[model samples]
Target: MHQPTKPTNPIEKYFSVINLYHYYFFFILFLSKVPVFWHFLSLIFLSPPMDFYCNNTLLIAANESHKNFCPCEDPWWDKSLFTETVQTKFDLYCDKKWIVSFTQSVLYTGTLIGSIFFGILSDKYGRRFACTAAVALLAISGCSLSLMPNITSFIIMRCIEGISAGGYIVAGFVFVVEHCGPNNREIVSALYHVPFNLGHISLAGVSYLLRNCDHFQIAISIPVAVFVTIRCLTMESPKWLMDQGQTEKAAVVMEKISKFNRKPHGSFKEEIEEYTAKRSVRSGHMHFIEIFKHRRLLLNLCCMSAIYFVCGIGFYGVSQYIGQMSRDIHKNIAISGILLVPASISAIFLLKILCRRTLLMITTFLSGVFMITVVFIPAHLTLLRVIFACICDCFFFMAFITAFLFGVELFPTSVRSSALGFLSLMSRFGQIVAPPLNSLPEFVTGLTFGILAICGAALCYPLPETKNIDLPSSLEDTKTLNKKNTLGDLEKPMDGQSTDIDKPDTSKKT
Candidate 1:
């Protein structure tokens, strides 16, 4: 699409150029999400908890004869799918199975911590530094998993990996969104997760081919390493730079983007200076806690955080349960990834016409309905259950995307990173609680997601709609969103006057 001519808004006039350069960089940033999926979901294939039997011949024979549990001293995990894994290597069957879920929880916890830490780092230093540090740490922590001598070390490394992943998500997303014009940010935000789905699809193939846990771990880390090495070529967000009063750096970056897009620079440097001059000077750096000081901001953050939490539970929990449903985990994951495409594609059009709050409510409520539907299906209908679960997942995915976009628009640029980080922390907490749900009965699991989805939908009602609105640049700008009935007030009839519509239609033959 071409940039609008003679755009009045300064942000629009400068960064609205959507051309090959913009597309190219967006794709590059999107590629960064690929490794995130690989590392995040690799555990399913790496240490699949398949059923196993005793390796002892006598115990096996006795169990076969008795048709009961074997009294074998040592258990031999099923290696038909994965040749080597934490489960097989550590004999994590029977009593030790709890460790597997605990490991995943640890990972989520790390991400929870990382969200706040990196949020502050991103806001304080810069998006470029946060992104670079996150990726670099991701490579180190991911590759280190293979060399870990024990499960404890492995879990520790997983936590670190989780931190980097969370940091990358917050920093990277804020960076990309800040670069786009207001008109384009919605589509950009909606489509950003497409690469993540691609990463899931590729993870299935990579894990299917590499079977061994260490090999798979190392394989995924390779891409992260490459990304880290080349990340120096990446640039900081000009909006962020300008917001921080670094106009010269913002000018240079804007110049580069303009040149690459083949658009005239058009005194963007002067515009930046003028914009900064008019902006109110901040008394101090903003904090996530400041959100609590504003009633509307706090309410929005709480409501959005609730939605994000439910999205987390549904997204991560459903995926885990489904990954175990079929014999072919690869096919299951690949199909899951494939399903994400239509949700994202549908969102592009749906988001344009629908209010952000409306879309979130509808999607979340539908997700709950589908999840509850799964509880009614008979146990014998595995295929039917899988189909319904996939549908629920798709709806939740849509809600998840909407939550991100809505949350970004709800807050101002100054505290955007921290606010998003806290929201993500809530999401990670939901994920942390999700792994344990897999151990519950199928109906219980389904019911949990259903209840949470309904609550999430209810929470959406309190949030302000953010469709087609410019990103708020400060707390004062965000407060203006509360002025919804300003036009309505002007249209109201005065005490002594009657509006044409309110008056009797004498011209018409009533």
Candidate 2:
């Protein structure tokens, strides 16, 4: 590989030259999180449509209360008539509410598949290409679901959107972290949720504005179109490029990034050369199975996966059912949306102050404690329940956001996406089981959430703290700190051999 010459400008020495454009890059990549916001919104829209189908049955029953045996009145209610229409096909086995839950589960199932397949594919290709392709699929499939003529078609479309969404989320997070410098990485990563919260607000607003099905579909489709347009101009990660041995191309992208920030073109060549020199000796071709070859890496992945799964179930179980919670308290969806702002803001600030491990453990434990009290709160004291739920919501949001950043930090660049993909796969499995669990008795839901929280707390104890630690550049680095209590010792080797347990001088590495 030909190395480009270093820039002569003294001003280019600092990495901050590219900081100005960081937010712009962040926003474009973070826009992908909108699908998560849409997933929640879709649940809101989806349930009602199913209700419209099944609610008719309830109305029919109410009208025929006095009759000895009430016959089906309308063709829509007739078993045979239902068999002919789109709604009738799924109406036979389940009520609309169950159908909604089933479809959402189907979406998660597609996500599980997509995360594994495209997560690996993103590594093989480039992050930008893989993510952009996922966005295109999202726009097409999401729009198609809105226009679906029948129940069968709607289910299929939801599955397609889910699969694409799975790929997009994994790729988006990897792309953002790869571009960020070490000090600012956690903050930038947490900002991923800000747009998602805005999207949730948009969903609530849209639902309130267009309560009817037709208008709701149009409202959701608009953002999908916007995402596709934004992704077209998005840049590939320079880190990923360097990993693939394309240092010159990485430098060109860095130069463009400097230009985009309205800063003078800095020494991209110098930075690339420096970064390449530090590249881990480990090759990029390491398979997924190798993630476990090192015990510490294996333990780290397990802990992260368990935390992710519990958080996924608890978070989605509570969040997806918020509409029901709102109705239970006689509040509107807009109020629910407004209430989410605090949690999102708290997440942004909390991530900055706390290390990834401590923050996640504390929040997860607290959220579970709060949830156990939810059912016991008196119905007459509506204010107490709402306040308690809001607190729980805050913890849930904080824990969820922390896990995402924590998971990214745990893996080396070699299998970063693949490790995340596997974690995502487990999370999807949690999502798959949550809906049915929600149908359990109130006591059961609280108990399950409590168990989830406790599990998350336990998992946090085993994870190596990554606060202020540079991301591991190779598999050897990953193993060096596998059982170490402090990250300080892993910076450099004391002897020529890999075994270096003593603290090294940090000033030397740079």
Candidate 3:
């Protein structure tokens, strides 16, 4: 008769490998952000040129052609031949620029819907399946956009890309956090964006190489293909499987993880069985209302959303306008692209050393300072503008990484994806508003940055620190943390609790 092998403690069996895999997975998912690089490149190519001769020539021509024909000076000039010609040409070149915002809005709308749908589906089906599906969709939509030859097709493809990107981002973050042990969760989450910054840096280089080439479409398509291929080889999150009552499959995944780490395999089935047995009693159906019912969760969500909103405005607004910034500073596209490397490197290091909240507050405040300085730098001082723009990029990237990690840590497992989705939706709202906000007068730029900085600094005071905290495992624990501002009142023994709000403890199970 064959003897049944004993199952090792499931939590301990996979804990170390889980940390390593989380890092590996962070790098893998970072590839998905490559699409944003294409977006960056596309913006750079489309931005108005800053050549001094060309700009002076255009202005001189306008002045000579219509010396006394100011539409503001004489209302009839608005209907005159010259004014009408200029207006028509402007409309032709930038017709429905609002289409960009409208397209983005539709994408966020889809994100709102997909977040709820995928959040539930991920819990039911598993994070691996949902994440893979999201990646496939993102790859297809992103690649399809490269083929667009007209405005309608471009807008449609962009909207579709938004949906896929939104879903992929939410699902990917949730999977990484879920797979990681408490000790490494914050760092893993922060590093999750390294590939994204790398993608941005790579896109800058790729765009510079292909800027004048007619085959720009090919440049965009290549990254999308790479993202899909990489995602196809990735493994499912074992923690997600265990949550869905698939201890047997979870154990198999644990074995694969052990093999990947080249570690000795102990039986993971016993721990899997124990975890599944406990979770099986409670049907894990998360409702939207539950997110708001808990004060701490709600407050955390609000702060996270606000942080993302401000970060989006500062980061994307500055990044998307890099071409303009480059032009104002008289830097070549290649030089501008090269300058982004420092910003990417800064994000990688700063995120590891600083707590998410402190870093966010500091970076955002500094980003505002840089933006205000940019407005005052005389156009003649090209070198000064370049230095300031690079500084802005560094702080912007730092704030972005911090914001991404903050959202991941705030919500519990049950609603992690949903909370991130909602936060992303709000961030997209800022992206939509940023262009108009940026187009405001030079003085307005300083004012806008000042307001955003002040709001972020003030809000940082009340928010709870998440650097060493394990994610809350239950609604009851979440409520206790909210009400008491500490975990002391929770009746459960320390061994039974999965997270400690007061300090970082790696021994706690999730």
Candidate 4:
């Protein structure tokens, strides 16, 4: 609410100030996630064997001394290409292939542990500390994958990467949103996906050119390693600093940001003044336990957990099976990642028009429809499946982005990052289950899709809509939330008429 400080120097009056801190903000924020991006890449670049046939040429050339007949039982994969995938390194093909799924589960188990661990760390030590540790850990374990001696080692390394990923990703998302004014909040929240989509697209192109998982691992790992010093460069969130009652430190952090962004030093003064002035109501400290105090918040947590889990499954499930959709694995993966750019941008506008609850429900349901349909398209129809699968990913991405921002809006900032960490823990739990569920489609065609669809419908209606009001800062700030239906809030905002920062909160009205 406060404007940046005006320049006292006479020469400064003639030149215009351009806010440049946003670029650096995104740079470090996004770069910190390089290793986490590998979560998707490993699956694609290290694709498991879905098809197998004897090397027909070997069979054709066999002399009379050997049985020349083609053997389907232990068929070698036809026309496979890739220097290394975790799957290939350990001979995890045919019958022993469940090992691939188990490795994925192991990675998520680390993520699960990391979510809880780093969450408490971020809350206790600060976002900067938690984020830096997560990134550094990610770089170390991720690059180590290239040197794995056996499947056991690979599994251990993957789990470590998962743990670190949980912290960095959660810390980064919360940090960016916490930096913004109300006008910038929604867009910044949605745009958080840009970095990941950029990573996803780059992953496709780089993997295409690199042609080996070992190189790919090292390629993505080194940047985070290189940028490890960013922790020193960045400051703790001023909002968090304020909540902790360190007003002077929070003000200093805000001033540094204002100088970089070229905003008047007064730019952050209003928020700081308001927080200090209204300390009792706005700066109430929240721990993980407070997250479950209200019935509405608790239900939201549960529904959102299920919804996020389904999206996680859809995300990894569709990605792993993209090869099944088309002959060109590279082409499909490229398209899938590329689609995220427009999908993310589109969500920004849709959130304004549709409200958060409807949009998530509709998009998720549509994604489910696409997934179920993908299964029935007859495996041989490659082009059609490709078309349908890409469409599913688009909707899934839309829902995923919405649900992410939705979770942020539903909680007070006191516990926002920790709340997200808890959600991350649940989502990773879903990811843990995802690898095994990947095998489910093989046994029961279209089954996974149906389950996701049911989850979308059941989970979408119970969560409160946040589009019409200011973000909550305390549990007291969210007391009215439990009284409103998740869907009813769309018609009548829980915060009294879906007001903006400029409007007064009318929750006490009637």
Candidate 5:
């Protein structure tokens, strides 16, 4: 007599279906990334550091000695291009120049808090709830920026927006990737950033047309408002639903997807039940601390944190200062944004040829080299400086895409959002400190990002490659990551093929 074979992951089986919901949801999620870029990169245009001269008669003696008269309470701003900005409105020049940096730093600080808060929220609740809540807050806070009467109120609104942006970033990413199968995961994840880059490109045009920071704020917030209204059309991650033991709900979602794909709805209850029975017994839900319980998981987190710190500082620091690189700030911003499109699009193809680790290492190291090259260029050649800076930023952007994709695959489903949130927090910390670097000498800022990028590239060596491997389901699975034989075996499976380790062999001799 022959033994019966058990069902494999029923949810994963649906992952390969190119369905209507998949296209619709992917578009919605990709669109979500646009607001994030708009919010984060808005500071460059909103608080643009314009040339200013102190008009205070009391500072006549001080002004005579200083070539660049600034740091005064009241200054006459050069508003030929921009009529009003945070720098001009708040008198964030001369003595108050540090406050200019504070605007960017404070926004990142909000993102820092959001990372931890929403990370936990996603894990405890669901990705859908966390995403919707975060975007709603983003919409409200962003629109409120135009109404802020004082700098304090403006800072508060920016912080709130940052928190929401951070949450949307991690949650939205997890939501999209979880819906994809290994076959399309890398490509889908990489293409997600295309809209984000488009946001970057469009911001320059928007900022050029709307010079007032208030109008720019209102304009950018409108899309997020539209997103909040349509968020209901999207569904929660079935992988997350299954992980939480809500197999019935997961099966329902899978059936909906099947129907949208124009395929006959098949029952998934038996497969889901079989897969759930094989999982380790659980008491309550998994917490963020669960990653610390395992050595490999902890190491992976630490390594990613260190690299994320560099990426955060390197990318944001450069972006914050890129406007100052040339006389035509608008042109520089637009060009930098344009370069990211190709860099982001290239990653989709690169992932097919190279493993995750190799691609990251190459991009990060080159980012450092290009940044350092910018420092050596003569100031007379502003065009060269802008070109080099844009190229360097492009490489840094690729590093960011690789990091997000790599980190998602590094941890288990139970704590994936939590781990990513922590990494994002570290990155935000890097962003917080980045603005201050602008006050330093040009070489110092360049050298800081350059050294950090090189160090980050080195850190990538110890981490295991996740290309074509199944996402870990539990803490125990992460422990085997460091073992040579385990990774060696997992890498053998062809792209899109199921790893035997994840699926139990139910067929045996009777």
Candidate 6:
């Protein structure tokens, strides 16, 4: 058999060169998430309390007459090892306990709104535009947090911080996933979580570095806050450009992709033109409504929504246990946070061996088992309980990563951000449910994990699989999934066209 002759264009020749620049922006955006969860974690390590014994004499005199819980003359919780917190600044303890929960609730409320707002922005305005704007929002809100004067101001800032984080996360995730080739999608998608774990670790480290709560907030906020401007330097996804009928910009981005990767120039222009010409006008203008018009799309979205809901609350529920446990909260969080390194590595290796369907089932099933087992351990066996609980959380974390990658692989470029945003919104709601569920154990010891276990087991089964397969590039492609079929077209590039990039590349990197 005769092989087709190679194209003579130097650009085409360059196509055979090794590709490299695909992930630069991915890493940049990944680093931006460094501060997203720190404030929440700070609550665990930094909350302050006044020195007051709840004696009847003190209580009656304080309430009936003219004294505060702690005498203004007596100040406490200012030890060398630990710093003051908003809880202490406002004296939000005992009867004021609801305030802490209320603060977090407002944050989630911001996230809910951000997810919807930014998801639409990603689908409509463009990834680069939306992500850049969100970066600004998140950074500004985070920086302003340490400056807030009253609890009302603090809670209001937290809500702003949540909204900003909401936009950053969804747009950043969508941007990175869109910019990469198929070979690295799982690693890149799962890579988002690594920074989250890092954020927790760094929050722990910085909490130690800056002893004062206000300074600690500045320390954590400043690191990521500085990088917000970097988003302005990043490029939009070529695939997103193409989906929106901006073929000219898409061509420019593809050229940049080739340059960054140091691949020899190839015929990216002709290939994009051919693909775009064949695409229908309706494909250019995608609506969120369009995502569910097809049966397969509807079924897949519904199942994915359910899984996000369960996994969202479930992951938080497990983590909160370790937080609430009688042992060292910092050590337990550090150790648990470190577990993500292994969980991420396990995901990277296992993704290559097991089909996505098999892996999703196995991880969720095991996570469920571990979650359930946490309930049966004798309370006297505290060490054993902690270990079991940590393992349960590790697996849930793994499952959560798996779901992130799977969701990216499931949707097409035009609507991928919207789909993921919808999932994130549901996840937030589940997270909203988690704190309340954690409270439920006060009434019933096993309530939270028991519910999560059932959810972990039941919710992961409905979605179609995409293990080691090509992703769909359009609604038409996604709509074609048969309930019984795996996503077999995983090798297809985002635009659904064969390009010189697919040809053999014996050339070494320049």
| Candidate 6 wrong stretches, greater than 4 Å | 1-18, 46-81, 280-282, 325-327, 442-448, 486-510
lDDT of 5: 0.80
Candidate 4, position 384, lDDT: 92
State the lDDT of candidate 5 residue by residue for 140-257, as single tens digits: 9999988988888988988999999988899888888898876677888899889887888888999989999889999999888877754578777888988888988888888787
lDDT of 1 by residue, 322-419 (tens): 67666788898898889889998888777766778888999999999999999999989989998898889889999898888888889877788888
| 178-272 per-residue lDDT for model 6 (tens digits) | 66545566666677788888877767677666667788777767765666676466777777787777877878877876777666456677777
The number of residue pairs in model 5 that clash at the backbone is 3
Rank candidates by lDDT, best first: 5, 1, 6, 4, 2, 3
Model 3 over residues 81-134: C-alpha lDDT tens digits? 122221122232233445444555566556655665666566666677777776
lDDT of each: 0.78, 0.68, 0.59, 0.68, 0.80, 0.68
lDDT of 2 by residue, 206-225 (tens): 55556455456556765766
Off by over 4 Å in 3: 1-13, 16-27, 39-43, 46-124, 146-150, 208-214, 229-232, 275-283, 320-322, 328-353, 369-389, 480-510
Residue pairs in collision within model 5: 70-94, 71-94, 71-95
- TM-score per candidate, chains pooled: 0.88, 0.82, 0.75, 0.81, 0.88, 0.85
Off by over 4 Å in 4: 1-19, 47-80, 84-88, 91-96, 266-274, 282-284, 372-382, 441-448, 482-510
Tell me the spans in candidate 2 whose CA falls farther than 4 Å from its real position: 1-18, 49-97, 211-215, 278-280, 326-332, 375-382, 482-510
